[model samples]
Target: MDATPSAHAAALWVGLHLILLLVLSVLVVRQRRKHQVVLGDADIPELTQAVRAFGNATEYVPAGLVAVAVLAVAGAQPIVVHAVGLVLFAGRVAHAIGLSRSGGSSILRSAGATATWVAYILGAVALLFYAIP
Candidate 1:
């Protein structure tokens, strides 16, 4: 295995997610301004939803990105890395859209959450496989 990490695939995915997160942040900011919410959702439901959607992405995306990057650096197969990345990105977008619209019982939200978990689990397994001697 090459000691130097080849992170081209990982970098692409990370860059895409970063942009997604930034767009989510902008959405939240726009909601806040539109609703005149100064801080902490301001008891506005839409604002609250937007904040949580953004927060959820922040909570989930970094760890996913790290896992993908580590796998890339450790020389995991490119297909596996891309698969995980695509699933994670789709999940985040779905979750954001679902949660932004309705607070409860959304197919998109459920699928998104499931996909995110699957990506994380698969990433961990891949990492463990590479790390084990």
Candidate 2:
């Protein structure tokens, strides 16, 4: 079986992001244990924030991973793959930090969202160019 650098690059970013997701999971667990709330967030601010952060990542990361993989497989340049990966990484981290700090809107969260969106858009457009022939 052979795999291109494109898949490898996507895997690299996916692995990194998955690691961060594990960290986010840990944060939620810690919050849960600290608050003694076994199920749900229990309406605690910290726990709620932690849960939402983790939940948000769950909602976004999987789709983003697929989009990135498709884009890479569809022949995006190596540099483009890496840049998208980096942006996704930074965006997820920043958004997590911002959410942990406050549930409300914040600069880091906003910037992180924009970066994530930009990464996806770039990947999609680049994939179109490569795929449409």
Candidate 3:
């Protein structure tokens, strides 16, 4: 089925997120192999952060994609869709870098968290304003 142009915008975001997920997965795998941890993080902070970064992406990326779908279905502009995608991608990357550095506190972590939350809120509001009758 050929997607409409707006759907293509959504697809672009989806594809980008998928690539991000794959990268995060590789990071986790490398962390595990390096540390030789079988199941869990084995109390290693870097491994813990790697796992959590990937885990966190699993939690948020799908929801963001859903929002993108809604926006496309609702006839949102492609630029809006791209904006959402860019923010989500950048947020995850930032968060991963920050978390990979430390399990606790970091400016990148905080900024990434903020960007991620903003993307979520934007998506939600876009649904409300664009889709809801």
Candidate 4:
């Protein structure tokens, strides 16, 4: 099977996601330095939130990106791959922003969580479609 298109598309979205993760990591590091937090959260609220925001991305983004890459390689439509990836990316950004601003709940946080879940489900379904035969 010709995987050139899929590879290209997967590279684009995965690279973008890496950049986003780097940005999120920087936020956590900056917050840590600002709060003089050398260890886990240092019991500081903002620092804690920053750490969790970064941590949350680590937990979700890798799996989501893998699913996306698999879908792409398995010949899923490029548009669908991109749409799901975009949702995941946007969700991570929104979630980070919302959590950074306030440790508690917010519309951005809720929307971000929802988007991430939708992306995951969509990616899984796409993979299943390709895997079925």
Question: By lDDT, who's the top model here?
Answer: 1
Point out the higher-scoring one by TM-score: 1 or 3: 1
lDDT of 1 by residue, 1-133 (tens): 5343347778889999999999999999999889888789878888888998999999999999999899998888888788889999999999999999987869999999999998999898889998986
Estimate the TM-score of every prediction.
Answer: 0.93, 0.93, 0.92, 0.94
Q: What is the C-alpha lDDT of each candidate?
A: 0.89, 0.86, 0.87, 0.88
Stretches of candidate 1 off by over 4 Å are 1-6
lDDT of 2 by residue, 6-115 (tens): 88898899999999899999999999999999999988999999998898888878877887787777877777788878887888888999999999999999988888
Compose the digit string of candidate 4's lDDT tens values, residues 9-57.
Answer: 7888899989988988898899889988887987899888888899999
Judging by lDDT, tell me the better candidate of 1 and 4.
1
The list of candidate 3 runs beyond 4 A from truth reads: none
For model 3, how does the per-residue alpha-carbon lDDT over 1-133 read when each residue is reduced to its tens digit?
Answer: 8778888999988998899899989999998999999899999888899899999889888988888888898899898887777787788889888988888889998888888888888888887888556
Using TM-score as the measure, which candidate wins? Answer: 4
Better of 3 and 4 by TM-score: 4
Name the lDDT value of residue 101 in candidate 3.
88
lDDT of 2: 0.86
Which 10 residues in a row give candidate 4 its minimum summed lDDT?
1-10
lDDT (Cα, 0-100) at 11 in candidate 2: 86
